[model samples]
Target: MNHTLTFNWMMGFVIAAMALGAGQAQAAYVIPMIGGAQLGPMDGTPMKHLDISFDGTNLSVHVDDMVPTPLLRPLESPDEFDPAEPWAVLTDKAYNYQYGWNPAGFITLPSNSAIWVQRLSQDSGLESYQRPPASPPYASIFASDGDIWQWSGSMTHNVYAVLNPTQSVYSASYRVYLGDSVTGVALDGYGSDDVTLLFNATVSAVPEPGTAMMLTLAGAAMLRRRRTA
Candidate 1:
């Protein structure tokens, strides 16, 4: 891409990224995510990705990853298994659409799956916007169980998706629509312009770091005693 186009491209990406971690707590068992976005196509298919658009007339949003990553807290249990509530996390996997599908115009993955999402750019060309989970800086929010988290342009952020042991599917569906002001009335006829992204993971009970280590040592000792005997 040319310098101007390149600058705009990166700017869009960074703008969207800014909304992600703005006011978000810095702790959640993270599962790293990877993917690339282009203003074009790849492998013949329009990469199903977070498609944010505005053609000088209207604003539209399309939403949709992943790689094996070391579990930050290998023991973070999802709501499906550990009802006691383990590490509430965000994950980046695939858009299985337990709901449905939103075809995209631009984007394609080179190899592995990824968590493609709306580039949270303020230049949405819309007057204003907002979504649920209320505003940012929420405490102890974000979970392995499906929930749509909004990315705001309040500030810049570096958010990472977390994984579950079982590898089930979950989503972060955010609503994107046009409004008169930041916290204004809706005007866009197209509602739910965005979808919280889905992620891949499974379930297993996880323990605190200390407890996990102790359990591991105990198990290893038991195994050794059995072999010695």
Candidate 2:
């Protein structure tokens, strides 16, 4: 066997092996949802729940429940609401249902992906969106459970293209919010206005360096055998 040809073959094998190993090593990345109800004189305690997971190509989001506390101040008239906003605006305060209470935080993910609804609980007032407005950055909104003031159920949202092999491992971010209403509404100040929920997710991919190295070594061993023959 020609020396040059043998070297080429060996390199190819090593590359292949490394790729394989790296791919196997790649695993999902999980992020936990952290937050709960917010209580204040002007604000009502609404429970927001979330669970998220990412397997490189797809992102799964689940909403456990969203319940608005009766303690919230009710709107005096319909004119206090804003129809143009993606979220609900009641009276002078704006209730952000598009993104969870923490609008500043978001999950990282890839671009140009579509969201698939796997499960939607009946009567669970939850609305969803791929992208939302800019003001208060948020991934999607799990709208209210219809006319019902409180909601209890789970819904799965699968977001595709969460990770791209060609781009950096962490390239995109996803923000999610779950609330009782798409547009802010008046709450009757009453009991504990606590929002209870959970959010967890993960992102992952196969690495290439290690796998490539293994392939190269294998190729070299084969090449040696050929030479001996």
Q: What is the C-alpha lDDT profile of model 2 across 16-95, one tens digit per residue?
A: 86677777633322221111112232444433434544444434455444543222122222233344543232223312
lDDT of 1 by residue, 168-203 (tens): 443344445444433334444433355444444345
lDDT of each: 0.34, 0.33
TM-score of each: 0.31, 0.23
* Superposition-based RMSD of candidate 1 using all C-alpha atoms, in angstroms: 21.3
Q: In model 1, which runs have C-alpha deviations exceeding 4 angstroms?
A: 1-49, 56-58, 63-167, 188-196, 205-229
Model 1 CA lDDT for position 48: 38
What's the count of clashing pairs in each model shown?
A: 25, 47
Q: For this target, which candidate reaches the highest TM-score against the unseen true structure?
A: 1
| Residue 137, candidate 2: alpha-carbon lDDT | 26
